[model samples]
Target: MTSIQVADQTFVAAAPELAADVVGDRASWRRWWPDLRLEVVEDRGAQGVRWKVSGPLTGTMEIWCEAVLDGFVLHYFLHAEPVAAPPAEPRELTRVLADSNKALRVAGKVMSFEVKDRLERGRAVGAPATARSGTA
Candidate 1:
């Protein structure tokens, strides 16, 4: 297992295709993961994207859009280790993992929430899906 492993899922009351549009933007990848350079490993259309990542860390990352009742359950994962040599001390590795965990978690939430809010527009909590897209 990598020293830093992060997995996050968010339920967005928006259709899978809509979510895919935002998450699959190649240009936006720079903004979403500024520290990592991502090369497409798989482009799964409405399903999502998998990337071979390299930069501060090296490994695979993915955003999977799962169709649920009303919308997509976005699953985000990052399994990577530092690109540099492994830290010599366990304490240093732990600290790095903790910090990376926070930063990555926040980044994932921001992306998911952006799509949720934009697509769902003024949807009240517990409101029914109202996206006008044909699939919705």
Candidate 2:
């Protein structure tokens, strides 16, 4: 019944609403976190998206994009437990949970860097921004 918490954030050179669009695109999830399956539990418009997670892990994940002076702050959180139980030993369960949490942290880090790279790379090279406000 214990939940592991994974959290991380990065800055992106895009507006909050634009960052949310990049984060909410389901087609990019697999490319970002291939081992995890995510379904939107709620979309917080310019704020971000909350998701129900399944696959190697089971629980909730949230990605928030906050507007900052320079651009956007992308935050990620994962509160979850391993889908498969470890060996019956209590210590084994603890170890498994720790390992899962570590993996989640790495995944979050990777996703954030990838997102930042994608969002900022174009801007760095003078390419026009592709991200647009979710609302017309």
Top-lDDT candidate index:
1
Candidate 1 per-residue C-alpha lDDT over 77-128 given as tens digits, one digit per residue, 9 for 90 to 100: 9998887775679998788789987898898888777767777887788888
lDDT of 1 at 125: 80
TM-score of 2: 0.79
**What is the lDDT for 110 in model 1?**
84
Please, what are the lDDT tens digits per residue for candidate 2 over residues 62-136?
988887765778899888776775679999877877877887788888888877887676564544443554632
Model 2 Cα shift for residue 116 (angstroms) = 0.8
RMSD of 2: 3.9
Collision pairs in model 1: none
Q: Which ten-residue region of model 2 has the weakest summed lDDT?
A: 127-136
Candidate 1, 96: how far from true, in Å? 1.7
TM-score of each: 0.89, 0.79
lDDT of 1: 0.83
